[model samples]
Target: MKPCPVLSIALALALGLPVPARAQSAPGQGGPTVIRARDDALYRELGGQEAIRRFTDDFYDRMLKDARIAHFFDGINAAYLKGALADYFCVSAGGPCDYDGVSMHNAHAGLGITKGDFDALVEDLQQAMDAAGLPFATQNRLLARLAFHHRDIVTR
Candidate 1:
């Protein structure tokens, strides 16, 4: 059976090493081409479902304490928000999970999010990761992926 991508990544990240890669040689080529075997390293590095859950919890906790972004979540359902965020991060990090949430634009629509708000959210996430003991490189990698959605998420 093919190994789960997360399993492979889990080993590498847990060992304090970079995610494993592979090299392929062309039939007539003298050199091998290096390539990443899986794009799900971020998901695995985040420690799968359990770790993601913890991270999400920490993120919300941090966000709630941050005056800049806390008001945006007023009266919101925390459980639902965390679940959706986990699913979104799972898919964004190439994990083997499905995200059924609305598109970034649709989700933030009518919320009047601004660039400052977006930056605050990112900061909150970083703090959450730090609290969760995620490696700085790992945190950066995950944030980079999430940053791609900022353009769609911030419309104010």
Candidate 2:
């Protein structure tokens, strides 16, 4: 039995790649029509590299100002953090970039991050996306993908 296209798409997403196209039977018994999932171009829709940089910058700015999560970044270099995050987010969003930073688990290993902290950070990120004028749906799509990393992010 052949696997469903949905499964294929899920597999691609799990691998951090673009969603695969699905073949659906056309009307009137015509040949199958290719249905390309919007998720495949999510990185581009999120405005590619420059947009990710701006979004990352705004996010860190808010994070630094927010008392709830500010201490987590205390004494950290903002410029370097922003660049590394831009690369991380770009790759996570299926953009044309590679992330060479430490793994999420290894990076946050001893941060003592709690669920509340993670949730608050997510809130800050959403606000940053809002400030950047990213469409709500697109923001949610990206957030959903990021949410999958929660296990690796929160150690407390």
Clashing pairs in 2: none
Question: Tens digit of lDDT per residue, candidate 2, span 8-77?
Answer: 3344346553243432334443232222233437788889999999999999999999899899998898
Model 1 poorest 10 in a row by lDDT: 28-37
- Model 2 has an lDDT value of 0.68
Report the CA-based lDDT of candidate 1 relative to the real structure: 0.68
TM-score of the candidate numbered 2? 0.74
Model 1: per-residue Cα lDDT over 54-155, one tens digit each: 888889889999999899999999999999888777766667766655666667878999877877777777778878888767776776556545566778
lDDT of each: 0.68, 0.68
- In order of appearance, the predictions have TM-scores of 0.74, 0.74
Clashes of 2: 0
